[model samples]
Target: MSAMTMLAVGDIVGAEAAAWLAQRLPILRDQYEIDWVMVNAENCSVTGSSPIDGFGMTTEVVDMLLTAGVDAITGGNHSWDGPDVDKVLAYPQVVRPINVSEARGQGLVTLDGAGRTLTVINMLSPTAALPGMRAPQPKPLWPSWTELAASTSLPGAIVVDLHGESPWEKASFATALDGRVSAVLGTHTHDASLRGHILPAGTGYIADLGMTGRLGFSGGGFDPAYFAAQLRGDNPHKLPAYRLATGRMTLGALLLRLDASGHTKAITRVS
Candidate 1:
């Protein structure tokens, strides 16, 4: 049996970043012999002031990713911020947070590639304390994971994207599921961690995959001026226009190689 490879990208910021990714992802795939590509697109649309208003994605951005050879797209807390939330939810290749109440999108998705099937699960950790952000904290996620495992017979390799702000939660969750899944990747923190390694059970893990967007900003796509204002106790509702960072931009992704039996063989990070 042959090995299967997959590349999972970090959070995508805006149209500019999306376009950059679309143009280059195919190249990266072929170069790395990747069988599938997954991306986090919760911030693909306009960024709003409030959590609800700021986290939606647009259909155009999703299409761009699909057209660029992305096999699946995962979303997080901001998954519902776009204009056509219903449409995004209906997409089979897109998965939203499994713990979000009344969320319209699937929490898990499966794709066939390299003569094997790969199951991808998207999850968000319980909300953490952000200095000026007000977001909902969901219930404990282990119950949801248990329920999912009981209900579904996960086939082939399993990849998980834990979008969260707390390092402790992400690390703990990944460690707990080390032997069960192929890879447990952390997203949403925007900065990549150097903690990529394979667990004792052959599962791959990372604290965060980092972000893909403009280089010199807080979260990659926000205007620094507006962000500073917010940090200064200004109203979030008075957010300034979206601004892509000047100078250079960067793309970050994690590549995983799995054996025929669905055990991780190697984990590589691409930036």
Candidate 2:
């Protein structure tokens, strides 16, 4: 079997870290011989003000990643928050929505690498931080996956990015797709889960991929005092803050090697 390295990343926030990835990704590809790269840019384009209006992915970031040889990009609840998201989703190589609908861009993308077609699917957990989404149920989504898979026209391999909250929910999804997909990777919780391994059916699974940001402060590098103050209902003046440090970001990614039938032969997590 041919080895196709697919690097999956967690949520990315801020410009500095984006620049770093842009600079570092190509080197990693050259060294590891990575064939495909997928990143979650939901929070990267958000301004954190509202769920719909975020400023995460600037043109610079996109250009950088494109130059760095990223095969496809995926996003979550924060996709609509940014001003440029609609346009960004227009790229034929980008995977935007979690479901297959008349909604702008696509959810399933095909990457021809290492002489095989790899199907990359992006799905949002119904209970995640979606600002405005319909009812959370599997009935409507099951058909979406069925239709998307039908449209691929290739059955070499399939990888699913199950973006959502709740570990049990993510695990349930993985179990459901046990023998179907090559891998199921979770995102959006910022906190990485300890659960990751190959299922009995050959699917590689992980509860959460964690996030890409400062490693100093807890809560995925966000200001803990600010979060605590908000919880305590206190509007404290001059809240303590940590200076954003370059290269302090931690990245979580899943590297998978799949068989010709899309079964995950091996799966590994890289921090």
Candidate 3:
């Protein structure tokens, strides 16, 4: 039996949090002996209300993850913040799936490491946030997940990063794939959920992994005055910009002890 110490972190906003994580995550890994770490980098770049990154910070974000020894990455609506992100996705080691057609990255890949072959799949759910996009559409992401789980092409375990906004969707999908996948972790909403637990069939699950970057602020990283101005319907206030604290930023993950059959014997969410 091999223990799969997988860390599925929340959405990371910008480089500042990355800096913080570089120092903090290793400590946690040492304390827990984590084997693999994956994070949601949807907001790692500065983008407006769209899914595309306006700023070309995806490369830097990925570099930070690599430096932090993260095994892979998955993102939500903001994965396509900039055109440059497509270039980074071409690296093959990275996984980014678009619910819509013509997305840049692959939704599924296999990782062989730590005496096990782990298959990691990334998917997006069609919730209210994703307009004009259909769940399991373009190429049927959810069904693809099931197919991958049932495939014999890959050995070892399976880890899925469900990037979506709806807790219901995440939970429902997780239940559907239970016993097939080793772990089902969710991202987006910037707030961690209390729904993570080991199922009777040994599948690990969570509603969301929470946010890694600035949070509890009105805007992504704006100061109080600027946030207030925007709230008051005032014209763009030119006051000094503020980089909100990462908040009582919590890093969450499902630690599972899976046997050779990809069955989780025990699962725990590191507080």
Candidate 4:
């Protein structure tokens, strides 16, 4: 049976990270013989001049990634960060969280990759420490995703990017979608999950794909010292300005192999 490979990238931390990826993604793609590429780009644009924070993706970076051969761009809690983000969301190939808002943008995208049709969905759990979400998490996955699948003329191999906080919750969600989707990949936490494996029902599952930014910091690519001061409730005045860590950029993602029917044949890390 013929098969194709997809590279699902982890959270990108900043514009530099995006630019860095645009330069080297082709090498990674060639190295893996990858057919399609998807990225969790919510953090591609960092906001705030003081007490800085990860917000949403920017247009330039998104365009850079797309030019670098990224087939799909997925968003998380940061999807609604600002008007600039709205422009990013409106990109034809971008997929925002389905439950967030239908009027905002599409929740999934169907693309032809390597001569095969593929469906990609981006989902964000409401209770995931998102800035504006309410106390109770808004879960529209079960019936909602199933409903969307039923209504759309989707290809057999569907991949879901479940951006959530809790690991077990992500696992359970993937389990529920096990036999139906081709793969369920988790993001949000920057660390790579060691559990990349094919489920009994033929779906590929991984707790997280990790980050495509600098590693070894408490907050993945941010100033850990500043983050610690905030956590300790130190005087905001005394803390240094927050900034992205300076280091060698790294690529974090997964290489998934699937057949025409969307059954995962192999799963491995691409870092």
Each model's lDDT comes to 0.80, 0.69, 0.64, 0.79
> Residue 61 error for model 1, in Å?
0.9
All-Cα superposition RMSD per candidate? 2.5, 3.5, 4.3, 2.6
Per-residue lDDT of candidate 2, residues 89-186 (tens digit): 77776776556343677776888755867877888766774434421232244666777667656355788888778888778778888988888888
Show model 3 residue runs off by greater than 4 Å. Answer: 47-57, 98-100, 132-141, 146-154, 217-248, 252-254
Question: Candidate 4 clash total?
Answer: 0
Tens digits of per-residue lDDT for model 3 on 136-200? 23345576665654664645688777877788888888788788788788876666676567777
- Pairs that collide, model 2: 44-56, 45-55, 45-56, 45-57, 46-54, 46-56, 47-54, 47-55, 52-81, 54-81
Candidates ranked by TM-score, best first? 1, 4, 2, 3
List TM-score per model, in order: 0.91, 0.84, 0.79, 0.90
- Candidate 3 achieves a global lDDT of 0.64
Among all candidates shown, the one with the greatest lDDT: 1
Evaluation by lDDT, superior candidate among 1 and 4: 1
Question: Which prediction has more favorable lDDT, 2 or 4?
Answer: 4
Q: Against the hidden true structure, what lDDT does model 1 obtain?
A: 0.80
TM-score of 4: 0.90
Residues 188-258 of candidate 4: C-alpha lDDT, one tens digit per residue: 78778876979989899999888888764553776678778878999978987677777777777899999
Candidate 3, residue 120: lDDT: 76
Residue 128 in model 4: shift from native, Å? 1.9
